[model samples]
Target: MSPSELMPIGVFARRCGLTSSALRFYADSGLLPPAEVDPVSGYRFYGAEQLTRATALRQLREIAMPLPGVEAVLAAEAGEASRLVDAHVAKIVGDASAALRKAADVMSSLGGAPALPIAALKGPVLADAVEQVLTATAHDPSLPVLGALRVEADLEAVTLTATDRYRLSTRTLVPSAPPGRTWAGTVSGDDLRTAACHIRRSALVRLEAGPHGIWFRTTGREDRYARLLTEEFPDHRLVLDSLGTVTGRATVSKEPFLRALEEQPGERVELRLSGRAVEVRPAGGRHPGIALPATTTGAPLRVRFELTTLHPAVSTAIGPDVMLDLRGHDQPVTIRSADRGDLTTLAMPVNPSHGPRR
Candidate 1:
């Protein structure tokens, strides 16, 4: 194209919603080079065709995509570009959420004073229990307490609980402890994950809680501590008790069903139990359906759930098959390993009127 056909940098930036300097920087970085340049005047020019790429670059930068990632996204085909963006978003969300949780724990600790140890438990057991329910913890900054794992211990058993309002999970383990010593506290999920890693590598683990912070120490290993969340946890027991009587039940093979859900392209899906088969399909009636054989009882029922919320419960189920206890269309569904009574995951079903998104 001739020089007359090329748009000046100023005009191009205005059309692309970018500043001239930003366009120049992108050019310097080889993201979007000028179509032509005046050697003597040092003026840059861009083709009108570059507007689409420039706008996309601006959006990618707005989301804080790294330079290399941006380049990869630009270089990819349409389908691959989408996958790249999705992968980057998932990683950043996970990392930023963890950092926020850690920062919140630190700030809470600084606000109060420290206390002495109160309870102890086995390292491996605690690690396993925490891992089992960690996925259920809420990561929302507005509700700090919900982002924590509630640790409740007594003479009989030690229980770890986490919930994201929409879903609740609890893992119970019998603890080897001295009688009459009981304790309850909420620790940030990020801190618990870190402590669990150290605890699993050690032979013994001890827990101490005070007014300000909680400490976890492993025999022959480094210790870790974080500020406890002082906000009161929701009465989870009441929520559990409030669940209506089981109106329907289904025992489905865990792996195949979980795989089918993972492979689904929609954000929300409908789960229907009819006779001895479970059918899964996109909520908006777009994709082909998947059917899996299951052992069902009580009644035929259909419910909708956000794929994000339902996948974790199915993926974490321990046994070969999982049992679903359905109360009603509006009630939360209780999912438990068919063979294990120690762990349970409850996910709230989506309203049918609100169709699932792709």
Candidate 2:
């Protein structure tokens, strides 16, 4: 509190990573008032105790936090301060995404290209489908299109599909209004994820395709845009068409099936399908596994899958019951809702392997 112990404005600024003028500005704003003032000479001095707050203020400002936000963050408790910081970062990211989309739209307009109508869909349904199908996407630096969602639309329905080589998921959504014509594009999955929240809140969404991007013009929410990838998406249809006939089939309650998988001790899981039960057990292990009551038909069979590939496919099913169709031991298994076949996932089984001992 003594004048001799106080640091002059220049020294304080140097130590705190702020300019002298910034100190004065914050002082005037009542955020970082100096420890002492030489009234006659109008000199300002700050104490060492103020360094922590000044340093935090500088760091907050570096992130472009507004004055009011900076003030609130500074005054908040530790937990609240952390939450505020996260919220601020989220807003910045959302703003940056929106700005980038707007810039792209502006550039697109300068080219004088017309926006073509793609399709119209129910907001909640489209949102759900996007979330479900996107689970199949993977981050592969070598092939970016694999990280995107392939959207194909026709007069009858619009289909969303994505694949990560190991798993392929697709859902067909009946459009509220038919498309102007048939259309297809691979959209950035990250952009779609960011737009999902807004899409879900609206009653309807009209999709408009431009040269470089697609727009989700919602009925009562802000329009969102997603960039289209130029890289070619994999020919998922080939895999679908080449699928072998199912040799074994089982319909089981989804909740119990998922629970059994959850309690499995290993990364590889084996499913044994017989007369009226599906045994979920760790792969290649002697452990007696959990069995769920199921209605199974066709030949008895056992199939193994990586837990990573199988869990999401079943968890995203629409209803209480899931139907699994198996072609053979090393084939891609088909998973879909027992009653509603609109959404389907094909999960590839890995080679038979031993699971960790219980």
Candidate closest to the true structure, highest lDDT:
2
Query: How does each model score on TM-score?
Result: 0.68, 0.76
Candidate 1 residue lDDT tens string, 114-231: 5545556778777877887988876777888878999887777778899888789998876556524678988888777766777777666677676755777666666667567888
Global lDDT scores for all candidate models: 0.83, 0.92
The RMSD of every model to the true structure, in order and in angstroms, is: 6.3, 6.2
| Global lDDT of model 2 | 0.92
How many steric overlaps are in each model, in order? 0, 0
